[model samples]
Target: MQFIDTHAHLDVEEFAEDLPEVIIRAKEAGVAKIFLPAVDLPSVSTVLQVCRDYPNYTFPMIGLQPEEVKGDYQEVLKKMKKILDASFAQSSPFIAIGEVGLDFYWSREFEQEQLIVFEEMVKWAVEYQLPLMIHCRKAQNELLHILKKYKHDLVGGVFHCFTGNQNEAAEYLKFDNFVLGIGGVLTFKSSHLREDLPACVPLERIVLETDSPYMAPTPHRGKRNESAFVANVLRQLAASYQVSEEIVASITNQNVARIFGISV
Candidate 1:
């Protein structure tokens, strides 16, 4: 059974010690493709290196994470633009613009900056004709508001590690340009995703992710996560939908391919 991890941070330091073994384990567990989301300027080199090392299985998405948006955002954006321009000239090094969105859960100090940065990245995605990988938190309504303004420009992408209500899910569906990312959270007993998601979004509009080194599924809940652990999320989702894991994998794989414009 082939599977795709639509969101993961394999370039993070947590995987630095044993990245080779981790990749082997992921392949052993049936993960055929893994998408890496950039967090900041410092992470770009490492993310690109990972993609180069595992060219057949790993792909990179570049963007400034919302939490990283700050007073020096103008400088950061300049650096990001330079890298993006250089990357585009060499090869289509990135598949999407993401791990980008609004996050008010941490602190609202940089809220305005975050919004500005988010809008700029959205425009970049449009100019490049690339998809977006959104990371929204307490700012869902605000995020949706901005997305609505640029709805016509969006080429669609994954709402990475989605955790929202039925109404929010409905709004995302209306955009017709995204897929809700299901991950380890679905394995939690109290996770509303298991109970509320199936009723709101079609299975085809769902994609699987790990968001690794965080949100590890049960049986590995407190441990550092790896791409291989995505299987646990697939299992839980299959149980929730009352279907075979193969079916869930197949549906999600197709969704990932469609959104990322990747062949799998």
Candidate 2:
């Protein structure tokens, strides 16, 4: 069965020593496409370089992660804008504007700044007519509020590592503008997702992701994740919905392609 990892940090330092091996393992595991999400200015070059090196496998998404938003965020924004502007000017293969959203889990001090940056990025996505990859933590309500306001403006996107309740899932469905990114969290025995997700979001509206170098699935839990481990997520999802793994893989792969305009 073919699979797509809609969000991963393969360019992060964790994979620096053996990225080639990681890619080989992913291919063996049937992960046909891997989307790389930019976390900040410093990592953009590395992200793009990885995509360039593995064009047949890796796709790129450009955005500023919320946790990376700092006091000098304006400078970071300028850098991101510059990179994006250059990509458009050069017709670079950036598939979406993403891994962008609010995160109050870390520090609330930059809450206002993060919101401003998020709104700007949303505006950019609208202008480019590209989907977004959102990251939310302890700010789903606030993220939903902003998403509602710009729902009409956005082309579409995904809520990476979605952990919201059923009502929250319903809100995302209302826009038909996004999909819930299911990852290792769903495979956890104690995860609320295992109980809440299948009843809430339909399988067609879900996409698979590993969020690699993090959130490794159960049995491999606590280890650094990679796209190869997406099979575990697929297995758990299929079991939850009482379907074959191939069916789950095909549906989620289609969902990722439809949302991000990538192929597996």
Candidate 3:
């Protein structure tokens, strides 16, 4: 069955030495497409270059990740806006504004800055009519508050690496057009996703991802993640949803197409 890794930081240094082989392995493992999201200003170029090298097999999204938010965020964002505009002018336009959102997992030092930067990214999505690849952590409440403001204007997006409870899942689904990005955490022995996910999110509202260079699935947990390992996530999702692997892939592929306006 074919699948899409809706979110992965393949541009990161972890894959620097053997990226070509990584792509080949991903194809062999049935991952048809990998969406690369920029975590900071520097990564924007790296992500785009990777997509360019792989062509249609890899896609790019521009945004400054919340965890990367710092005191100089405004300057970084301003520079990124220019690059983003230039990207659209190119033949291969970025598919989403992503890997962007609020993260309070490490510390709250940049909480206010994160919120402001996230809102700016949201506006870019609304302006460009592009889907979002959101990365949210302990600040779901704050993220939801900002998102609700542009609820009507948003085209669609993914709640990337979603490990939230049933109530949070339901709240996100209220957006109707968005989808949850289910990744390796689902396979973690200690994760509640195995039980909680099935009860909260329908197969159609979930898409598979690896968050590569991180969140590797069980059996490979603690090791560096890659798109090839996304298949493990797919298998676990099928088990969680009590459906065939093909069914999970098909429905999640459809969800990817619906949100990103791309067909695998």
Worst 10 residues of 2 by lDDT: 255-264
* Each model's lDDT: 0.90, 0.89, 0.92
lDDT digits (tens) for residues 1-264 of candidate 2: 799988899998899999999999999999999999998987888889999999868988888999988899999999889889988999878899987999999679999999999999999999899999999999978887787888887888898898889998888788775888999999988888887888988898999999999999998999999999999999999999989999998898888778777767
**TM per model?**
0.98, 0.97, 0.98
Task: Compose the digit string of candidate 1's lDDT tens values, residues 52-106.
Answer: 9999689999999999998999999999999999889997779999889999997
**In candidate 2, residue 234 scores what lDDT?**
92
Tens-place lDDT per residue, model 3, 83-169, is 888767875469999889999998999999999999999999999899999989898889999999999999999999989899999
- Which candidate achieves the best lDDT against the true structure? 3
Over 4 Å off in model 1, which ranges? Answer: none
Quote the positional error of residue 164 for candidate 1 in Å.
1.1
